[model samples]
Target chain A: MSEKIKFTIDGKECYAEPGQTILEAALDNGVYIPSLCYLKDVIPAGSCRICNVKVAGRFMTACTTPVAMGMEVENDIPELNELRVSIIEMLFVSGNHFCPACEKSGNCELQALAYKYTMMVPRYPYLFPEKKPDSGNKKLFIDRNRCILCKRCIRAVKDEQGRSLFAFKNRGNELAISLDHELAENISDELAEEAMEICPVGSILKKEKGFQQPIGHRKFDKQAIGSDIKSVIK
Target chain B: MSKPVVATTSLAGCFGCHMSLLDIDERILDLIELVEFNKSPIDDIKVFTKQCDIGLIEGGCCNSENVEVLRAFRKQCKILVSLGECAIMGGLPALRNGIPIKECIDEAYLNGPTVSENTEKILPNDDELPMLLDKVYPCHEVVKIDYYLPGCPPRADLIWNALIALVTGDEMELPYEVVKFD
Candidate 1:
């Protein structure tokens, strides 16, 4: 058995196994930390800084930072939430996220986060950067306009041989997620569904399936994102 | 005291947001009693005859005419509200933002697959036509926007609640179900 470390998040005592990161420990203990990129059981890329929390008066990403014994972590606070909201807004203005026309609108995590943060309007000017949709793959399509560069699909969507189906195509400013067309052709339906689920936004979508669930019945429609964890913590 | 005058307009939009306003249904009777319409399509008022307490703008500015109308609203109304995705973030109209204006005009008039009839390849150059902007701009970017209701067409209850809150000076209820971005 691994040694358990006790920590305090916003003054509430919590415990986690030795190898667990702060985010893993927090979620396990029913603490909901707003995150866009970090996914459970996957390697934390720390790309999206939405989960940045103050650890011992220093800001750090909870997903990449491991919990230490008696560590004082600030999870929920106005200062941190304000910063997170700004990050969400920055993601919004930088991309051409037309939520209304998107297939994954109701279930999108980025949109859910915007709702959670009450993002009435982004403070920054909309970049409206030109991007194109790639329908090259038989199973799914990639809408680059809606991608937040979270890298979730790239890190999590892999084949039996442990090969990533998605990858980064270009460098900074022009950086975009690209799919391996050869691998994509043979992707199983299950893996195709997994890719869609793994994507935080509507960027990756199964070709034929769209708006499957009716409005008001979709995920995040009735309940706000992280409500389950919030309930557990409460 | 007089009823709070309200004005509304649709600039570079599909008018879906106005349809959502009508989605308020029976409560619109209540709304009619609570507030008076001035320069809104609902009243078929062509121009602003009096100052309005609230102005609900339904789209972004895509042309010179839209800018003029938006500025007129700003001058006549005390509080301005961006009523949907378009007004808040340039919505679908803003999709042309990434593409160069010249290329867009060419695609629409000269080189597109469906433009076979335009053998003359003449772009609309009428003096009466409003000149298109280089890019679609969110209403807030052009003029000061007081509040934003973000939806393709904001939910009817959301619109009703916002109008009520504004008129009665009551706190607006932002329930999770009503605050969707889509």
Candidate 2:
């Protein structure tokens, strides 16, 4: 293997291979860099700013920034953590995230991050924007109200011709993922499930699959997000 | 000294929050020893007999009556807390927030799938009826909320911990397991 690029994050020594991003290296070193919109082996969207880390007085998305030799990065710090918490809070208020009625409540990564940060209430006012759900597709249901526009579905769920199933429909505040019905209608059940799983929020879901996992048994029910990376946190 | 008085109300909620408060289980007796219930459904008191130290409100303001009641609570209680999801952010009732009031009323009283009995197609214009607001409002939007405990029906342990901390003036212990929004 190529000589691992040695670096330090928050004073702790970390190593990275040539092309691995800061987030990948951090995770390999058992350092959890909390992020949304980052799926392993997929092209980085860096749409969600939760994974932003400070390096040399510059804040950049950790998922996109490649690790360098002797790089000093700040992943978890009071100022950065507070900023991260604020981003999470903005995501909560900007969208109509009514967790109680959601199918992906406990399993949701967004909700789990909020839990990790202990957001008692959003700092901003609730917008309560009306975004109706599209249940037109046979296997999938896209609830626009919950979509943070992370582009995970757009980047990951694709047809054999390399056509994306989901695409951005509008601009500015009206921006949303538009699922191509023609492509989506013929989606396999496995792909439908994959589409739902890739979405960080409850925006994309498989139809006819109601809350099958009872409370306390769902994915994030017991463990906080990123807990599996570093069991004993600093 | 007399026990710290606690008052509670359910505005636009399903009373599940109240049930969760009771879900404190045998600790209800312990809670009673720490504080006295006043102007609450648990005691069947319709009106506030006196001033209260803390007022736990479980739901958002959905109507004129809710606003008036919330204002009254603000006047009578020293500390007002938004107890659950509905109170904090309008919850399920607020789903109608995006739609027009006319459409909602028409759908409810006239055009709904279950609507049947109104042969005269009359809408209720009773003077005693509480007027519906344009949209369901979080409690803080109407009046100040000193504290917020967010959950569907906030976990029983969360309610318990918050109550004890409030009554004792100790720091509230917010464990990861209890502070869930689900």
Candidate 3:
């Protein structure tokens, strides 16, 4: 541990221990730092770049950057807001994000983030990549149309779990997640469930849970996971 | 200080399993009396030890490297636990089956605006990347797993209970809610 550093988020003066990322500190204090790629406990990849904030003058991913003494951070800058919106828009276009039919509707982090930012219509045109029908795995299926390729699933399997279940099979947006095997019988429904939990969007969702709860009845949007704490402001 | 040696690794996952490992708030410190954090990315780590009493793995295997790691842990640890969806099933990355691999690559690097000019030149470039399987698979397809704690990052309680069972030798019987596959 070292000396505390001071910064401001949403105009609140905040203190963080040395080496703590700005996102972690803000999160500890109940300040929301919007992120899809930066799951706690995992090595934060800062891939989504949605949590970028203006520190003094320039912008940076709050999840990756370490804190310094007396650093000024503007988390809600208009430019950062625009960047977040654009990133969300890109994510929407990149995949088949049909919220109406998907399972993760109410609890979808991407949907919640989108709503938080008030993005009703996608600014960018849909990628509309003609995708293969859901593999009908009998257990789970990956609707690539809804995927954002945050790579959280890949990193989890490879680095965190010591199993390289997934790799960036191709480069750039062409990078669809594939098993190492060239055959279809390699995955199980149990693993699919795990993928569904971390996926922030409707892309990788539970097959059974899909279309089961019609968005409105799903809980947790007004609470903190299983906790009884309610969002008084919401 | 007799801390139980602990090993945490990813299988075929999104690393959310490891995140779930730390999700027990700071109360995890209480368990430190009986558990020693050994080979993990979060703390002091040296050799990839084979004699871990408890092994925690995330992700599923889509490559040879994943296979090797899984074998190493199975050989060393007394108890091996599959942590997340990737390791449990193939995960979202396994979703590449629905489209042609070439179409996926073309749309991303060749046709998409975000494509870097350098991405096209690499050996085994987009064209040479492993072809997508007709369908995604799970880890059990590759190995005989000892225990399955299923959740994208299986609920924290499930993780904690599985660990406690390791000490007690009480075979964990997943509830219908936990194991019922869609």
Predicted structure with the largest DockQ when compared to the true one: 2
Q: lDDT (0-100) at residue A42 of candidate 1?
A: 94
Best by TM-score: 2
Winning model by lDDT: 1
Q: What is the TM-score of each candidate against the true structure?
A: 0.96, 0.98, 0.50
Question: Residue A9 error for model 2, in Å?
Answer: 1.1
Using lDDT as the yardstick, the better of models 2 and 3 is 2
Q: Rank the models by TM-score, top first.
A: 2, 1, 3
- Prediction 1 TM-score vs. true: 0.96
Predicted complex 3: CAPRI docking category = incorrect
Could you give candidate 3's fraction of true interface contacts?
A: 0.00
Q: Model 1, stretches more than 4 Å misplaced?
A: A230-234
Per-residue lDDT of B46 in model 2: 94
Residue A100 CA displacement from its true place in model 1, Å:
0.5
DockQ of candidate 3 relative to the true structure = 0.01
**Model 2 steric clash total:** 0
Q: List, in order, the clash count of every candidate structure.
A: 0, 0, 49
Q: Give per-residue CA lDDT, model 3, range A69-153, as digits (tens).
A: 7777787668788899899878865665555345776677776666566453455644446554355555456666777777777
Question: Worst lDDT window (10 residues) for model 1 chain A?
Answer: A225-234
Between prediction 2 and prediction 3, which has the larger DockQ? Answer: 2
